[model samples]
Each structure stands twice: as C-alpha cells, then as structure tokens.
Target chain A: MRHTIPPRSGAAFTLERGQRLTVIDPEGEQVADLLAFSRSDIDEVISSGRSLDYASRIFLTTGDALYSNRSNVMLRIVEDTVGRHDFLLTPCSADTFRILYDDAEPHRGCFGNLAHALAPYGIGPDRIPVAFNVFMNVAVDGDTGALAVRPPLSRAGDRIVFEAETDLIIGLTACSAPQSNNFAFKPIEYEISS
Target chain B: MRHTIPPRSGAAFTLERGQRLTVIDPEGEQVADLLAFSRSDIDEVISSGRSLDYASRIFLTTGDALYSNRSNVMLRIVEDTVGRHDFLLTPCSADTFRILYDDAEPHRGCFGNLAHALAPYGIGPDRIPVAFNVFMNVAVDGDTGALAVRPPLSRAGDRIVFEAETDLIIGLTACSAPQSNNFAFKPIEYEISS
Candidate 1:
C-alpha cells in the first residue's frame, strides 16, 4: 500500500522476509534516511560498518545487501534510480542545527523523528545507528579527508526498492535537515508489497 | 596514574574535566579504540559525525576536539604523535570476525570488550557509538569511496593525548582485530594527569 510521510516527519513499520519496500522521492532533490532492525531481535540492527566493509564501497545501490550487526542480511537493494546514497553520516539531529546551521530555533531533524516513530516499537534513540541516507549527496576530499554535503541528484519520482531478507522493523524519514533536502522539505512516498 | 590494557582487552575509567588522558602504544603498531560518555548524562555520548562535521576532516589528531551527540565538546586532542586514526568505522565486533575474517572460532573483538568493560556503568552495547580509533590506519579511496584497513604507523612509545572537556566515562580497548594491529596483538598503555 502507498503511504506518504509528510515533510520532516518519519514512520515505522514491519516487513516480513521476501517483502519489498519502495521509497520514492516524489519531489525533486529530497533525501530520506532509512534504517532497519531484525524483528526477532532489535539488538541486531542494520550496520553501516558491516555493509560497507563487505561491500567495500560507500555508495550502495542495486544488488547491495544491507547487513545487520550480527552479520545477517536484513535488506537487499533490488532497484535504485539514484545510486548516490550516503552511509557515513549519522541522521541530522537537533544538535546538527545548533552546531552546523547556528539556527536560533532548531527543528528536531530526522534523528529525533525516527526516535519518536521507533519508540512505539520499543527502540530507543540509542539503538539507532548510522542510516542509509537515500539520494543524499556528500563529497569527501581525497587528500584532506574533509566532507561536504551537496544537493541530491534525485529528480521527482525517483525511487529505490529493497527486498527484505528477514523479518524487519524499518524506520524511515523525510529528512528535516535543510542541507540534505536542498533547503526545502518535501513528502516521501513508500509502498510495501509481498 | 598509568594503566595497561592487555592485548585484545578493554578498560573503563572516569576523567574529570581539565584532566588529560594520554593513550600510549607501548608496543609498536597497535590500535586503540576510545569512547567517551558524558558523566552527567550517559545519553550524550561521543559522536563521530558531529566531530567530523565540525572539524571538516576525518584524520583527527593533535588540536582536534571530539564532539558529543549534543554537539558539546567531549575530548580535545592536546597531542598526537601518529597522525592517522580512523573515525569512519565502527568498533570491530564478533560479527566483524565472522563476516570479514571467516574465522571458524571468531573472537569477540573490541566492540565486545568495550561492552563488557562498560556494562558496570549501566552502559549497554546499544549505547556504544563509533569510537575514535587511535593509531588505526584506514585508507579511504578518494575516487571510489572504498575503504581498506591498513597497518598502524604508531611505533613504540607513540602516544595521543586528550584533555577532557567534561567529566567523562571513558572506554578504551586494545583492538583485537588483527588487520588493525598489523597482524600482531599488543598491550596498550594509558596515563592520566591533571
């Protein structure tokens, strides 16, 4: 079924093994932060380190399997319209606004939204790990190791599909951080199918 | 005071604000994983993304300050002998051995050791975040964004010193992963001074 997560908000749901989830950027240049946890054990949450270590690449796309903390497969990307995703960044939070943007009134970013959404599933903020930032553009300087956030390349209707490898609880957000969304927030659409 | 963390083991201690922590590679080519939590609030742990975001560089060394999740200063690097360290990767765990090394008898790596050492302080495994990996050589390919674990360059007596910016709970480990230590395990020494 199709679901829309309003701009700067998040949602959490369950997906059985073999199910598919498609996250769509309905508006151009928006980013989504995705996270997965094993349903049988929340402690076995998705791990960016394990996935990147095994994949040997930071940019994960079609055919890449996101691994759990216990080395188990949680989700495998089967389709990706925008291959440039960021695995290095933690979800932007209230601190992000306070520190990076120097905003006088900081909105709780994706991290806080996810924390609230996942709390019903008994997942706390501390349980959250680095997210698979869908369609987010980040540039890393090869020499100095400095990082810069760039505007996403995803256009309207761009989507990424993931096939669940195990029973999972997924937390997803329409990123609230201004830089990640190119300074504008938009809704994110997702569909789940068996 | 000086303390030794045996090879493949870990320790936890407290440091008052303004005190200095000097982590020493007593034996050549060893790596140490370091973590800090605010003594006043365990929820506000050290954050790799915040530190890297503010610093704009990943190879943290002398003159760098590690930031907490709340964007507060946690530890400031007052001195560093070996310039290279890893902030991108998570602490190596049992899953790392199983998935990366394919070991029949996988040893719980630094993650497990830190979890054990910090459990007494009410810090669970889930609370652990990406550690500041001292003397760990990680090469990130500028073009492909691929990462490789390389041998540390720290020789005997090499040390990195951090001045506590707040009262903190510190977890330190002599990394168990062979690749990080140049295929040899060795004890790590640390001293604290006001």
Candidate 2:
C-alpha cells in the first residue's frame, strides 16, 4: 500500500519478515530518518555502530544490511537510487535547534516525531538510537575529522528499498530540521510489498 | 583521591560543578569509555552528535565541551595528553564480540559495565548512548567513509582531564574489548580534584 507522511511528521507500522519497504523522497533534497525495532523485542533495535562496524563503511547502499544491537540482521538494502545516507548522526531533536542553531523556539524534529509515532509500540525517546538518515548527505573530512551536512543528492522521486529480514516495527519521518532538508520540508512516500 | 578501575571493569561517581576529573591510562594502550549525566536528571546525558556538531571536528581535545542531550554543557576538556579519541562508535558490547569476532562466549563489554555501574543512579542499558572513548584511536577515510579501529596512541601515564560544568554522574570503564585495548586489558586510573 502507498502512504504519504506529510512534511515534518512521522509514522509507525509493522513489516513482516521478507516484506520490502520502499521509502521515496517525493520532492528532491529531503531527508527521512528511519528506525526499526524487532517486533518481538523492542530492546533489539537498529544499531548504527554494529551496522557500520560490520559494513566497514559509512555510506551504505544496495546490498548492505542494517544490523540490530544484538547483531541480528533487520533490514537489507535491496535497491537504492540515492546512495548517500547518514548513520553517524542521532536524529535531530529540539536540542539540535536550541544548541546548534540557537533558536529560541525549537522544532521537535525527527526525534520527537519518531517518539510520538512509535509510542504505540512501547518505544520511548530514550530508546531512539541513531537513525538511518535516508537521502541525507553528510560529508566527513578524513584529514581533519571534520563533518559537514550537505544538501542531499537525491532528486525528486528518488527512493531506497529495504527488505526486512525479521518481523519489525518501523518508525519513519519526513525530517523537520532545516539544515538536514536544505532549509525546506517536503512529504515522503512509502510503499510496502510482500 | 585516586581510584583504579580494574582491568575490564567500570566505575561510577558523582562530580560537583567545577571539579576536575583526570582519567589516566596508567599502563598505556588502553581505552576508557566515559559517560556523563546530569545529577538532576538522568535523561539529559552526554550527546556525541551535539559535541561533534558544535566542535565541527571528530577529534575532541582540550577546549572542547561535552554536550548533553538537552544542549547543556556537561563537561569541558581542560587538558589532554593524547588528542585522538573516538565519539563516533558506541561502546563495545556482547554483540560486538559475538558478531565481529565470532566469540562463543562474548564478554559483557564496556556497554554492560557502564550499565551495571550506572544502575545505582537510575540509568539503564537503553540509556547508554555513544561514549567518549578516551585514548582510543579511530581512523576514518574521508573519501570512502570507511572506519578502522586502531591501537591507542596513549603511552603510560597519558591522561585527559575534564572539568565538570554541572553536578554530574559519571561512568568510566577500562574497556574490555581486545581490539580497543590492543589485545590486552589494563586497569585505568582516575582522580578528582575540587
């Protein structure tokens, strides 16, 4: 089924093992933060560290597997049009705006959206780990260890497909952070296939 | 007073504002995972994203402030003998040994140690975020976005000192992972000065 997550909002749903989820940036230059948890045990959530450790690379694309904290495969990227994504960053939250941007009134951002969306599945803010930022472009300078969040290279209609290796609860957001989405927000589309 | 965190173990303590903490690599080539939480609230813990976001560099040394999830300054590096450290990786855990090393009996790594030590302060396993890895060396290839964990550059008596910016709860570990500590486990020493 096709679903639209409006700009600056999030959604949560369950995907059975072997199901494929395709997340699309309906509009170009948008970022979507994605989180996955084991349907049976919320404690076994997607782990950026384990996935990165096993993959040995930051920019994951088709053929890469997202591993859980328990080191179980959760999702495997089966298809990707935009290959650049960020797993090194925690989802932007109110603190991100208040601290980095110095905004007096900060947006709740993807972190809050995920917490609110996943609350039905017994997930809390503290349980939210670093997210797989689909379509987000983060450039790391190897020489100086500096980081820069650049505008995504994804054009309109770009999508990444992930096949579930286990039954899972998924949280996804059309990121609200200005710096992440090129100072503008746009809706995201997703479809699940058996 | 000097305190020794025996090999592969951890410790937790409270630090009043302005107190300086000196974490020493007493025997060298060891990694210490450090975590900080607000004394008033456990939810406002150290944030790697915030620290690196603000610093614009991954190699945090003297003059850098460790930030909390709530965007507050929790600790500031006042002195550093070895400038290389890692904030991009999560503390090693049982899953790390099992998945990465194929160990049949995986040791409860720094993550477990921190969780156990900080339990008295109401912190749980899920609350532990990416830690500040003291004296650890991590190499990131900018072009490929690849990461490699290398042996620490710290020699005997190398230390990194931080001054508490607020009343804080601290968790420190003499890392148990063989790779992080150069295939040898060693005790870590710490001293607090008011």
Candidate 3:
C-alpha cells in the first residue's frame, strides 16, 4: 500500500504483521507524527515510554524496536536514511498552540488531523496516543538540559522503515509547527510492503 | 453511572459535557491512574504537557482545567478532598517492569488494566496516553529535583471531582506498583452524574 499525506492533513492504514512500512519525507524539512495501534486490540498500542525503556535509548535508529505498553514488540526499525527520529516530544496539538505560543486563533495540528483521519475506524480523540516524530530535530543541551526543536536534519527523499511485529493500524500527520520552519509543511509519501 | 474498579483492574466510560466524575479512595493509600479523551476525536486527547503549560502549575486542584493536546478544555477540577495529583509520570507499564525491576516474572500494571477495560470500546493499547496519577505520593526533591514515588497521603473516603467540559471517555486503573506499599491495592469507587 502506498499513499500521500498532504500538508496539515493525515492518513491511516493497516499493515499486516511482518510487513514493512516506510515513511518518506520528500521535502526533507517536514516532521511527520507517526502513530501506531494493534489492529486486534487498541490497548496493545505503541508506547514511547516502553520503547525507551526496552531500547535504553531516547533517539531511535535502525534496528531499534518499538514496544507496546505491555512490553510486546510492535515495530522494529529496519532502515533509516536519517538517524535522528525523536521519541521525546508529544505530537503537536491545539494545546501546543495555546500554551507554548501566543496565538489565540485556532490552529490545526497533527492531533486534530490524526483524530479526523482515524474517525472512520471508530477511533476518537481519547484513543490517540503519543507519536513518533519522524525527521524532527530535537536537541537536548547537555549542560543546561534545555530542549530545543530544530529543523529537520533529513535531506529530501530521506525515509525511515519499520517492520511490523503485529497487525497494525498506522496514522501519519504532517506536523503543523510553523516555528520549526515547516511553515509550508509538505506532503509525505508512505509505502507498506510485505 | 457508578462502579467499583478492583485492584489490578480498571474500567472505562463516557461522560457527557457538563457532567461530573468523582473518584474516591475509600481506604486511602492507593494510587489511581485517571485518563480521559475527547469523545468526538481521539487525536485531540488529554495531554499532561499541555495541562501543565496552561495551568502554570505542577499539581492539580480546584479550578485547574485539564487541557487536551489541542488546547481544548476536557475536564475541570471542581472539588477535591486530597489536593495532590501527579501528572508527571507515565502509567506503570510492562516495559516499566523490564527496565525498573530485576524480576523475571510478568507483572500486571496499569497499562494492561486500562487496555483491557477499554477493549469493549474498541480502544487498544496504542490509544492509552500518559495519565494523571491520583493520590500517588510522588515527592520531588527540592534541590536535586529527583522524584520518589511514595505511598498515598489521603485517608479513607478522600476523593477528587472533575466537571467534564467536553463529551469525554474516562479510564481509571488502580496502580499495580508493589514497591509503593500498594501490594493490596484496593478497589476505587467512581460516580459520574450530570
């Protein structure tokens, strides 16, 4: 399966166990919030906290496994063109705009987009979990411990591949953070294959 | 609606806008993971990060609004018998077992319980988000900023109430951490009324 997720919008698909899904940042600078859930059970979804605990690393790279909250293997990173995928930050949402920025106007964020995309599956807002920030550049200052979100380090056409360990429903949203220099966040191309 | 969530187990329900939900620690000294989502959208779910940012405080109490990731108000703390609630930690999951403890046996945790409880609603593991640890005594070292999870501080019958701002789904789990002297973790009584 292959599809294009337009800027400021999102998409969802089901990937069978043992299949591989690759998300491509065709424009390089855009961040894609990649989320996943077990197809058979929604509660057996991917958890970043569990992934960090099992992998013992914050940033994900090829060969790392994404674990579910139950400690089951969900997805394994099989390939990566950009090695700096971030699991530290939560996906951008409307609260992000109201609290972090001074903007009063309603801003469409990945949270809303993901919810809209997954609605057809009978998944609502309460079911959306934290996402993997693909191609996002987040720098943690060693001395101060302050976190900074930078522009993507990935070049155009860079992609990250994950092999599913279980039947899964995947959601992807082109992040809407204008401060990340992703003002004109571009579409993302995704392909899933066995 | 009213129900009792047994120790090591959980339950889920939907609360209409303007309704109130109260969670009671009847015997006290127990921790409950309280989570919520927008009934209309799953991606615009509750966000602890956004809640802290909007409330401008670490601890939640009366008048504090629980903000969704999209910055929308999901619930407002309207009353409380115990003032301490933790929004900093992720619920204990199976990965927490693997990383934090040396025990080889599989241990039940809030993550699994929430998943099971929400299964009938078509919610799975991936939908579970970071939760509010209610009545869990987490002491933050003033100088070092290190956190220690202690036993609950509230006495019997202590409760916290929230008025729903949106149509919402709520999940609660009696925390399964044995180290916190919650080995005999008791059931929690919850009531949702308009």
Please give, for every candidate in the order listed, the TM-score of chain B alone compared with the true chain B: 0.99, 0.99, 0.94
- Where does candidate 1 chain B have its weakest 10-residue lDDT segment? B49-58
lDDT of 2 by residue, A1-194 (tens): 78999999999999999999999998899999999999998988988777887887888999999998777899999999988999878888888888778999998989999999999999888778879999999899887888899999999999999999999999999999898889999999999999
Estimate the TM-score for candidate 1: 0.93
Ordered from best to worst TM-score, the candidate numbers read 1, 2, 3
Preferred candidate (lDDT higher): 1 or 3? 1
- Model no. 2, DockQ: 0.54
lDDT of 1 at A124: 90
Best by TM-score: 1
Question: How would you encode candidate 3's per-residue C-alpha lDDT over B57-103 as one tens digit per residue?
Answer: 55778898888766688999999888877765667766577667755
Candidates 2 and 3, the one with greater lDDT: 2
Model 1 regions lying over 4 Å from their true place = none
Report the C-alpha lDDT of model 2 over B1-194, residue by residue, as the tens digit.
89999999999999999999999999899999999999998888998766887787888999999988666899999999999999877789998888788999999999899999999999888778789999988899987888888999999999999999999999999999998899999999999999
List pairs with backbone clashes in candidate 2. Answer: none
The runs of at least 3 residues in candidate 2 whose Cα sits more than 4 Å from the true structure, single-residue gaps closed, are none
Q: Candidate 2: what lDDT?
A: 0.91
